[model samples]
Target: MTVLYGIKNCDTIKKAKAWLDNAKIDYTFHDYRVEGIDADMVAEFFAQLDWQNVVNKRGTTFRALSDDTKASLSAETALPLLVEQPAMIKRPILVHQGQYHLGFKPDQYAKIFASA
Candidate 1:
């Protein structure tokens, strides 16, 4: 099964959901805000994607972080932070057939689905 992880209100998540619906792809939406994310889950993401790819540096949550926290970010440091504040994760992480894709783009989805 395909699972999409993100916050509900994010514009990118909204667009990703719409794209999935329009493509008629069957998927499960896992809202981090509502469903909550765990350390193990965050670790799984890190295993598939690099910390930079998974973390949303552009978001307000990240911007609000202390300079020390930002400068000291490593997988170990960021993992706990990501678990504590799931909104800092990049939106719409798609997991399908044990493969992971971070963020979204129509062409990218098309390619992924086609190759699948």
Candidate 2:
């Protein structure tokens, strides 16, 4: 099954959801902000995806961290942080056919779902 992970109220998540709906693509949205995230799930993502891409460095949540914490960020440190603070993760992580896609854009979504 395809899964989309992110905060439910985020604008980028909204756009991604809309695009999926318009394309008639079925997806299960895992709202990390409210429902919480699983460490194992994030760990799986880390194994296959870049830690830098999974951790949203540009978000206010990440920027608000202590410089030391930011500096210490790695797959090890970021995993627990991500599980504890879902907002620190980039928006709309689309997972399909066991592949992870980070962020959102119309063209990106189009290509990601082209095989769906």
Q: Could you tell me which 10 consecutive residues in candidate 2 have the lowest summed lDDT?
A: 44-53
- Return the clash pairs for model 2, or none: none
Relative to the true structure, candidate 1 reaches a TM of 0.96
Best-fitting candidate, scored by TM-score:
1
Model 2 has how many clashing residue pairs? 0
lDDT (10s digit) by residue, model 1, range 1-116:
99999999999999999988988999999999899999999999999998888999999999999999999999999999999999899988999889999989999899888865
lDDT of 1 at 58: 92
- Each prediction's TM-score versus the true structure: 0.96, 0.93
RMSD of 2: 1.1
On residues 1-116, what C-alpha lDDT tens digit does candidate 2 reach at each position?
89998898899999999999999998899998667788898898787677788898888989899999988888999999999888988887888998988889999988987777
**C-alpha lDDT of candidate 1 relative to the true structure:** 0.93
Model 1 stretches astray by more than 4 angstroms: none
